[model samples]
Target: MEPRPPSEWEDRVRELARQFSYPPAPDLRSRIPRPGVRRPRGRRWAWAAGAFGAFMLALGILLASPARAGLLEFLQIGAVRIRLQPPPTPSKPAATPSPASGAIPETRMLGILDLAGETTLEAAQAQVPFPIRLPTYPPDLGRPDHVYLQGMGGPAVILVWRDPMRPDRIRLALFEIGPGALIEKITPQVLTATTVHGRPALWVEGPYLLQTRSGRWELRRLVEGHVLLWTEGEVTFRLETDLGMEEAVRIAESLSAP
Candidate 1:
């Protein structure tokens, strides 16, 4: 046995046996599912589906209601704010605007509200945040022949001066705005920019439509020169008169506690 130590032929036979005698690999092919056939089992997918459904439901509800247009057009100067909106559909073709793109419905410019109630000067002053002022330069103008309180935005004070020259004619109207003032869908025939006591003011002259309520916009005529709008303290003032600009400014400057 010592003489027969490993021949070259025996070594080659041993090497061949080692190459063909390895163990079989585990069955990995059956463990993993096919990529296209597998479905997601995570809660993430469920959450994503629910979120998408909720968004669609909210969008549908908004569209079902009366669609309101966003206020893309508006102007704010001093204490007054103006909003321009799409006009209501008229049965007949509407008249072409005088010069501006849109005008306030007439109803608001003259008298924004139908005021049936009257109050004394003391009572009216107590209800509003701002003091009611009367022009003192024109002594004849005296106390407001008519005092009306209306809620347009907040509380509004209306002071009417009857024409001394003409019988039963309105000479001037002064309005004090509480909280603020709003003019909707307004396109003025003439608009002037000026100042009073170094405070910025506006003069809106001519005819325009104004809207406060949804379907109640009406056109108002400005037979007088212009409407003077100015703000003092926390309140805004609107003055309508037949007087000239200087006279209007004088009246505004003459505002004193009545």
Candidate 2:
């Protein structure tokens, strides 16, 4: 009985000694403090990064909208047209002619509505503000009742028209006035429609300079049934001065194309 008891007791004592001798790794709690500062700092940086990213995304969406994009594009394209000429010079004066000739050879060209028996050379001169004759050539265009006025003057040309039948409808035509064969019908896009001395007209492409032939004096006329625009290389002239439409008609009524 005594030997058995020694064996059991020795085993129990050995187990207890081993457990206490290990001294549990220095209470892990002391090595690491509560709520370490490093973790919170890292979390703060991540939150700030996420907030900044969100703000940039919102701003990008607003600027890319369709209406704002179109406005930006519109600012890039522009449209403009203009014409310039030199100052007019003095030149030889033109002679005053009898209204009956109904033809002005000095005039580089002329146009009129042929009235056959109704309109006469004598009648047209009486209506014009200055001495002028009826056009000798046929109507410039088709077999239509309306007549077309066209002519060239040195570096410039003259264009005008009226209805022979109506005698009231008048048109102050335009063509390229230059050194070469006058380009009939100046590019309309190059001119601006306006009222010059009360008549409807298309001014040469410019801020206010009306004529196209450089350094030439231009003459503009508008009467009850007639309208005229003429120029001599350096000596321009205008006949009917005021009330363009009405004056244009009056002058047009006086025409009788030969």
Q: Give the number of the best model, judged by lDDT.
A: 1
Question: Candidate 1 residues 1-258, lDDT tens each?
Answer: 458787544454454334332234648677466777654643555554464334223322322222321323444443455433355556666664321334333343353233334677788888988789888967777898778775655777778776778745678888777775454325445455556775556677644333223334345532355788787766788888888888898999899953
Q: Residue 65 in candidate 2 has what lDDT?
A: 45
For candidate 1, which ten residues in a row score worst on lDDT? 60-69
Candidate 1: segments with Cα more than 4 A from true spot? 1-72, 83-115, 206-223
Residue 170 lDDT, candidate 2, scale 0-100: 47
Model 2 C-alpha lDDT per residue in residues 10-81, reported as the tens digit of each score = 454344333322223446565464574455664775664464334223222222343433332111000111
Candidates in order, TM-scores: namely 0.56, 0.19
* Candidate 2 global Cα RMSD: 39.2
